[model samples]
Target chain A: MLFDYVYAVDMAHTAEHGARKAGTRKRADAERNIAAIITAAADSLARDPDASMTDIAKAAGLGRVTLYAHFPSREDLLRSVLAQTIAESTGIIEAVSPDEGQAAEAFARMIRSCWPLLSRFGSLHAAAQRALPAGEVRRRHDQPMAYVERIIARGRAEGAFRTDLPVEWLVTTVYTLLHAAADEAAAGRLATDAAGEILEKTLLAALKPE
Target chain B: MLFDYVYAVDMAHTAEHGARKAGTRKRADAERNIAAIITAAADSLARDPDASMTDIAKAAGLGRVTLYAHFPSREDLLRSVLAQTIAESTGIIEAVSPDEGQAAEAFARMIRSCWPLLSRFGSLHAAAQRALPAGEVRRRHDQPMAYVERIIARGRAEGAFRTDLPVEWLVTTVYTLLHAAADEAAAGRLATDAAGEILEKTLLAALKPE
Candidate 1:
């Protein structure tokens, strides 16, 4: 009777351990699926704003059931994709050493690194605008600008940028011009590199002291 | 009997003339309603993108039925508003003398004249994007840029604007900046006059020779 009780206890312990492992594995699988879905959605939606959920599921190489399990609706998925895009953009901006070089060069580097993101997600932006409320969209778009704001402030303080215009307006000016260049590039009127180059030159010129 | 026949003919003629006059009045009334609806819609939509058709009808002092008669749906009304806005903007751009003064001064005049259009229609643009196809929105938005294009070309040829950048890029830069200024003004971060002045100064600095 004593041996049987010990055996029963051990069995219970093993079962609990197995269940915990399975739970962890399930959670990890979910994480992977979510990342894959977001990435695939970004690509698919970027290429075609009207991409269906089934299309995204196929692109992600996951079953429709799994996709639905992760994202219950298209808006939820778009929100996640936008979140990821913002995260990636923030990461990119963070990696640039804004204080390491001339503010102009730092600004140029920032523009060059970020323009491809705009080009890649051009159509996705339209879809996001449709799916999301304007204020929400504006908030997410503003996330990456914080980094830009810092750089501009640094430049202005160092006399590397003009002080004639308000820094806030200047930051918005950069934001607007970058978006316009992305639009031009997405339209195939200008290559991505050419657009980046033009932005850098025009902005640098605009930022210099009059 | 002849007198009776002449009286009957005159009665018929009078009735026909009255009907013709009533028809002309009805047509004139319809034209007036359409103009009022479009104008009122522009004002309401520019203030609020989610302005309802009923709200617009009330603003225009017309019945809901009349508003529906003229605009079958909210999207139809938005289309008319956008069209009217574009027409007014084109008229504003046309009045700017892009060749009368030095290219720089003409460019400044163009910026000052057109900035208010953007400021007034800021929210209307958001509504247009939501209702219209992206391509259609883009095409309509590009309508007013033609005049800006001509001014930039003139500036470049006259050596007033930089020749290093492409004329098209320069034109778009001006457009993007003007829209940015409008956005800032709409957000209450910058006054309309201050935004215009900053745009003029910054853009002029950028357009000058390197």
Candidate 2:
């Protein structure tokens, strides 16, 4: 019903605006619908990794036809949502100085700044892993992971982090710990307020030289 | 075809053993069938957490009817598989002396002994979490987790492990690390041959006193 009303308004505006203006207006409306669908999908998928397309469409206040017209397929929709989420998190990570001061301190600063991204989008990560190929999922994570990898490499080079373990293993361990912290907080087993502090302390302890 | 042959042989045995003995014989056959299904389900689930009942039935060499008779639902089958896996691991964990030597050494022993359990049954864990309630899944882990908790408590008391972090969080962190090691090994990022050694080193490093 809501979509029908929007469609009626769009037709009336198309008649009033003429061909060129109406073409631009239609394009803008289509872009708005796509944004709404992506936003709704991210929220829906975060809440339930297996949320249905119909449910997401309803949440977006658009019909299934409109949603499909934009996404074409579930994979396309998931990829877009993941890209959007990564873009948002990249903005947060950029604000933290990964090269400033001691490597360990930089790691702490990065974790404190970006921990919420893990907590907020953990479910979305799970969803993408289920729908996308392993390589595809890993590739999407490459950019964000590179930020941590640099800090870990600097830590190792400076002898601030343990050299006994492989740097790749250490990077994987940090990510696994962050994901675990998010799971614990979501399960109510750990206090959300203290999760970041706990995570930073634990990761620093684990990464320090023997 | 194989099950049909087995059915025919069983019918012949029923007649040969007579009514009284056949009842006992039939019970034994049922038990054997149940064991086969559980074994097949574990292997199938470990390979693919989403393995269907039909696939499990084919793998067990029994019909879907027989499989369903034994396990009316996927949850029932998953619970039985999880329980059996835990029982096997419990036997392994029992052999390790959690009280002998330094707490850190004892932890190494326990992790060394039970690390395979985490690696082997990781997929089944994912399956159970999907099929069962969160509390139900956690309850199934109580026995295995209690052993680790006791060791962590002793370590904290003896000042072998760090006391700065909450015991609960530390226990969870150890588990998260183990699971991550298994995942890395499975992905070929971490060598299976060195996983236990690496796991022991990283976990001991994280748990040691500052």
Candidate 3:
């Protein structure tokens, strides 16, 4: 999946480029600090959604005023972090080769690419799904949903999937299971690799000829 | 599936016969009041696991003394609610027959029976999963897990399901997707029926033979 690939790139850059940018006296330093703050805040919020602003500031090694300057309110900060994460995820969804191999294989690859972000930021995803009005998030959600729907449709056209249920139902099911498996992984009930395997099997089953 | 049927029977009895009994006699009324108190406390605790005893008593329409008489501490009350709910769920699990028809049909029926309770008490479940190792909740989780394991085992033995993944992983995926779908349903992102349909497809995909 392109989303998974984007996340990998983002994670690598954040780790390798973070300290180097901090040492330089330039715009890079400021951007690095902002990224650090967002990452720290995301980690704390994952553990406790209601964690205080001061606590997040402390985790990011910034003063409350500095944190507020970068992002005005708790919601604003959270929204920014989520937007960045979603952008990275969207990039991955766009990058996948929809024409590559069988529909099920391509779909599984997309899920694998996106699993890390979904697993790490699952609570935030849940919050976004709940907090955002349908207008904003719907478009974001539709992008991925469309991708999955296309895959299911292609599978059916190729005679690989049973055409008994609506493609929308299949898309919704795939996303729900992904989000659910990610949540379970976050909660320590299932390992990430195990979740990936489950996703693969699930996609295969959903696509198998009846 | 058997377990879910049993749970429905038990829940129907609790709702119908139990309610009627409480209405008939003073002693039964008192017991019912106590049960109601516990249920209210459980609800509050689900929303806020750290809610105080006084807060629970206030919510339950009981005095602190009476609440303590029924459940001496927060742990006791939480444990009792957990046990009762799991026992009820176990009844439902025991009532299902995964062999009732084709595997997919049986799985769909099972998911329908199981989704509502999971959706309603999901937060409490998340709390219980987190509160393990400090109490008897761990022991209680075993019953449902065992029931699910048996279903998966039976499915695999009958050549109705893929044998690559552990049965436990399949069981956990079923619970996870149901919980996730419930979360979506609760948040109004998806209607209840829609969520149920999505869950059914997801489970069928995950469990059906490849």
- TM-score, ranked from best to worst: 1, 2, 3
Model 3, position A206: C-alpha lDDT score: 60
Candidate 3, residues B97-157, lDDT tens digits: the string is 6446655556777777777776666456544443433224445778776756666777788
The ten-residue window of minimal lDDT in model 3 chain A covers A129-138
List, residue by residue over A1-210, the lDDT tens digit for candidate 1: 999999999999999999999999999999999999999999987877667899999999999999999899999999999999888887887788765677778989988888778878767776776677655666786868877788888888889888888888877788777767766776676777677778888889988888
lDDT of 3 by residue, A51-158 (tens): 578988999998888788888877687678777777777788778786577977787788888877677774565444434433344456776677778888888888
- Of the true interface contacts, what fraction does each candidate have? 0.69, 0.57, 0.45
- By TM-score, how accurate is candidate 2? 0.81
- Error in Å for residue A125 of model 2: 3.9
Please give the distance, in angstroms, between residue A12's alpha carbon in candidate 2 and its true position after superposition: 18
Give each model a TM-score: 0.88, 0.81, 0.61
- Residue B63, candidate 2: how far off, in angstroms? 3.9
Instruction: Name the candidate that leads on lDDT.
Output: 2
Off by over 4 Å in 3: A1-32, A43-55, A68-75, A97-102, A116-142, A157-159, A184-197, B1-31, B37-84, B96-142, B181-201
lDDT of 1 by residue, B91-178 (tens): 8877986657777888788778877887887677777776776557657767678777777778888888899888778877876677
Error of 3 at B174 (Å): 0.5
Number of backbone clashes in candidate 2: 0
The sequence of per-residue lDDT tens digits that candidate 2 reaches over residues B44-126 is 87767678999899999999999999899988999899899888977787788776777888899999988777777646665
Residue B80 alpha-carbon offset, candidate 2, angstroms: 2.4
Question: What level of docking quality does candidate 1 show?
Answer: medium
